[model samples]
Target: MTDRAKGWLVDLRPDERWDDEACCGDLPAEETRMADRLCDSASAATYIRARSVIRRGLAGLLGEPPAEIRLASEVGGRPVLPDHPDWYVSWSRSKSLLLLAARYGEPVGVDLEVIRPISPAAGVLRTVYPRTAELGAVDQSETFFTAWTLLEAAVKATGRGLARGARDVWLYRPSGESRCALGGIRNAGEVPWSGRTEQFAVPGSSTRVMTAVVTKGFTDPIHVDAWQLPDRPPSPVTAAAPRRLLRKEVSA
Candidate 1:
């Protein structure tokens, strides 16, 4: 098996050419569905930036532009590339950032969350994060967000969203480079999802942000590049910026 088959995680920055502003415009129908679910401007902007990068990156891999691509939503509402079936793709973003990950022909899902400090009401921790309690009892506030991202990635990979239930998927803190398979998600029960983490330093400062990806095994040493979006602060990307989620024959 080639390295590409093994899958990979890439880190992209603003200096990269793929982050063109012209890429942003109207949201595809599928994305509008996702956008409607979000309530925050930061969330909306992040989604837009991520969508643009994913589309452009995939197009570049296919040697084409975003306009030439076509995407269809599965019954579950996840986006897929009409030209490619074997491949899986996902993107995510946060304040001043974006992330994308893809596997040649594998199911892929990615998520990024800014670790902001938060203190919730009593019983809230147990109701929302049951697994956190099993992690040997530590500071919930510090570990809450990290664990949250892992769950988000797993559910996104499953493509059922909250409808399948977030509690069905679980993750443990990383003890080694090898990631663990948590709970049953959609078709794959306790599927061993491979993943990687990225920490980016904000421009002109030392502030750092984190993002992560969960995907099927791939043989490729995932190629990572960057694009300077005209609107958002410089962020990172994996694969060519995605246009319409999953695509079969990516050009450029």
Candidate 2:
């Protein structure tokens, strides 16, 4: 399938974030309640900004004003453009970064995470991959987050969410430059979603974010914009194999 994917990385910091009075007005009623239920103030903020961006961005690409777009979530809370069933939309946030992804004619899921050591990693490792021994033998934090993001993107692409796809999906990368493949439930069948992991820097900060996108039948080099700012023009996209998660690369 010829899937066209475009992604934008928006900063969620108070000074650099992209929500305005109009954005607030365009937010659906369910969105406000979802924000009200968020315990973390920061998360509540991210949720508002992310939802607003998704609506606005999708509207831009669809040639309509934000209010005209009817964004809805499927059974697993994965957002979709119900009016245009051919379009797929997804977003993810971590700390102060938000990624908004939209693709035409294919299912898509995107996720972002600020990479660091996980304190409760051991317990989580056993919980997600209980049936596997090889996953436990590798670097727990590294492998876990790698697989974790893949699982998230995969589920989102399939509209399955973690409740249905978590334990079934596993990560495997044969080489540093090789494409990462996701395995199915108990490694039995081919999972519908395929994943790509990218590491990018926040323009002025030292913080690096790990981002992943999964699309149904997507091929090499899906268009990814790691540093698209609200005021600045988008940087050029270079779809290359992902670098190892170490903090050495300076460019996307």
Question: In terms of TM-score, which candidate is strongest?
Answer: 2
Which residue pairs in candidate 2 have backbone atoms (N, alpha carbon, C) closer than 3 angstroms, thus clashing?
none
Error of 1 at 75 (Å): 4.0
**For candidate 2, lDDT tens digit of each residue in 103-177?**
887778888888777756646655655544544434444565666677778777777677776666666655552
* CA error at residue 117 for candidate 2, angstroms: 1.5
Clashes of each: 38, 0
Model 1 vs truth, CA RMSD: 9.3
lDDT of 1 by residue, 2-93 (tens): 22322222233334443333334323545645744566544444565556666655554444455445667777766687787766667666
The per-residue C-alpha lDDT of model 1 at residue 139 equals: 41
